[model samples]
Target: MKLTILGCYSATPRILTNPTSQVLEMRGNMFLIDCGEGTQVQLRKHKIKFSRIKHIFISHLHGDHFFGLVGLVSTFRLLGREADLHIYGPKGIKEIITLQMKLADSWTNYNLIFHELTSNDSELIYEDDKVEVYTIPLEHRVYTNGFLFKEKEGNRKLDINAVEEANIDVAYYRKLTQGFDVVNENGETIKNEDVTKDAVKPKSYAFCSDTMYKEDIVPLIENVDVLYHESTFLETQSHLAPKTKHSTAKEAASIAKKANAGTLLLGHYSTRYKDVNCFKEEAKEVFQAVELTQDGKVFEF
Candidate 1:
């Protein structure tokens, strides 16, 4: 799995920073997490193929999170994109984008499918053979949701030597890998466990941004391989966190520590502090594995 940070700052864009946006590539899927202003430009900067982004996920109706969506939809049309695009966002996203297209008369030529989420509880929003995505309801000023992407458990691996010793036919190898016992060429019952090894552990990523210190989310993101939580402020300025419905670096770390996440990625910085290392330091006080996110940065796991 790989994550490319297009933007990670909070609220507004700046000369050196951008708003919230990112591209996550996993299990043969490229997912756009958000579309802040200049997202396409960032995509170009990273040399990510725009055509590969079939699914776009918006956290909320915040302009900083989704204002560039309409422009990107139009750009897809301009490029004569033929592939259908799927968009998942909070309720009113469809209306927000459709109204802009209505006023500009710039509807996408390709199919634009919208999945509007309205549930207060977490729900599976997208799934395929290899991956499943679930919504992580968040506490924000407006209705918001984070996303949890989990790779589907893989099939068992075949022990070639064990299978060969068992005199299993080549055709039965597939069955062994699928965790099924099969009759060998010699009419022997071959146990799957005897000829197959365990599959690789699947990876998981949880994106939780624009939310306050929400402990209920710990269960939803338990044991995630990577947790990207918003650190819009430092512990020193924690007073502003509740006021703005945002989380401090320490609070985000607490969530990560509670979730037992492998790594904690801090982003959506308030941009008030000139040094981003302070966020990492504060988070490290609570969780050791912490990384500060910046535009144009890439992380692979």
Candidate 2:
């Protein structure tokens, strides 16, 4: 799996960084996490094909999280895209989008499916053969959710020595990879365990944005391979974090520490600070594996 950070700045924009958008590429599919303003331009800059992104997940109603959605949809139409687009967002998003379409008198020629989220509890929102997406209920100013993407376990490994010794037919290799035992023409039962090793453990990534420090998420994102959490402030400005329903670098690090994530990606930095070194320094004090999220940076797991 590959994750490209399109934007990373917090409430305001900066000369270098954009807003809060990310693209996750998995199994030849691109899944967009957020669509802040200028997302399409960033996608172009990264050489990402917009048509490959059929699924989009909006974290909340915050403008910084989804303000670029309508523009992107319109751009897709202008580009003559005919594939269906699936969007998962908070309730009322469908109304807001269709209202704009009605006012402009421009409707999409392709299918647009909206999955409005009204439930406060976490739920499985999307799934396919290779990947699965789950909602992570979050604490924030507005109703919000984080998303967890997990890659499914791979097929079992073939034990060449055991297969040759057992005289397993090549025609049954596919079934063996599926963990099935087969009988040979000689009337011998070939055990799956003898011919196949264990499957590789799958990797998982989690995205958490625009939320206050909430520990309940530890269980939901426990031991994730890669975790991206919003860190809008440094330890010196921790008082401003909870008041604005945002998180400081230290707070984000604490969550990562408790969740035992393999790597912690810190993003959504406030523009008030001229430098971002403070965020990295503070977070590293708590979680040694923390790293800053830079626009256009690709993380592979």
Candidate 3:
């Protein structure tokens, strides 16, 4: 899995920094997460193809999280896009986008599909053969959700020498790799485990931003390989966290420690601080593996 941070600041876009937006590339699919202002420009700056993004995920109705949605869809029309675009977001998202389009008399040329979510409980939102996505309900001023992306395990690896010695025909190689027991040329049943090794362990990523410190989400993201949590404030300004419905770096680290996440990534920083590395230091107090995020940073796992 590959993730490119288009923008990671909070509330407003700046000349040097931007709001929340990111792109995740997994299994030949590109997922645009949270289209803040200037997102398309960031995508262009990063040289990521607009056509590669078929699915867009919006965490909430907050302006910093989804203000760029209509602009992006209109751009797709300008480019003469033909492929369908799927948008997963809050319940009123469709109405909000449609109203603007109606007033401007500008409609998309491509199919626009919206999967509006209202459930408070965790649920599967998207799935295919190679990947699965689930919603992680979050606590914020507005109805919000985080996203979990998990890769599906592939077929097992074959031991060529063992298969040949077992008198298995080449025609049954596919079945062997699929973890199926098949009859050999000698009329003997071969066990899949005996000839094939286990497949590569699948990877998982969980993204939780623009939320207060909530323990309920820990179970949903337990043992996640990578976790990107919002650290909008530091402990020195921790008093502002609850009041503003945002999390401190220490709070984000506590969540990561409790969830047993492999690596904790810190982003959505408040512009009040001159140095963002302080977030990483405060987070490292509770979690050892901590990484800081900025615009144009890329992470591979």
Backbone clashes for every candidate come to 0, 0, 0
Sort by TM-score, best first: what order?
1, 3, 2
RMSD of 1: 1.3
By summed lDDT, the worst window of 10 consecutive residues in model 3 runs over: 196-205
Q: Candidate 1, residues 1-301: lDDT per residue as tens digits?
A: 9999999999888899999999999989999999998888888889999899999999999989998898889899999999999999998999988998999988888999999999989999999999999999999999999999999998899988898899988987877778899998888898899889999889999999889999999999999999999999998999999999999999999999999999999999988889999999999999999998999999999
What stretches of model 3 exceed 4 Å from their correct place? Answer: 160-167
Per-residue C-alpha lDDT of model 2 across residues 106-157, encoded as one tens digit per residue: 9999999999998888899999998899999999999999999998888999
Better of 1 and 2 by lDDT: 1
Give me the runs in candidate 1 sitting further than 4 Å from their true place.
Answer: none
As a TM-score, model 3 comes out at 0.96
TM-score quality measure for candidate 2: 0.95
What TM-score fits each model? 0.96, 0.95, 0.96
**Please, what are the lDDT tens digits per residue for candidate 3 over residues 121-205?**
9999999998999999999999999999999998899998999899999999999989999999989999999999998888888
Deviation of model 2 at 263, angstroms:
0.7
For all candidates in order, the CA lDDT equals 0.94, 0.92, 0.95
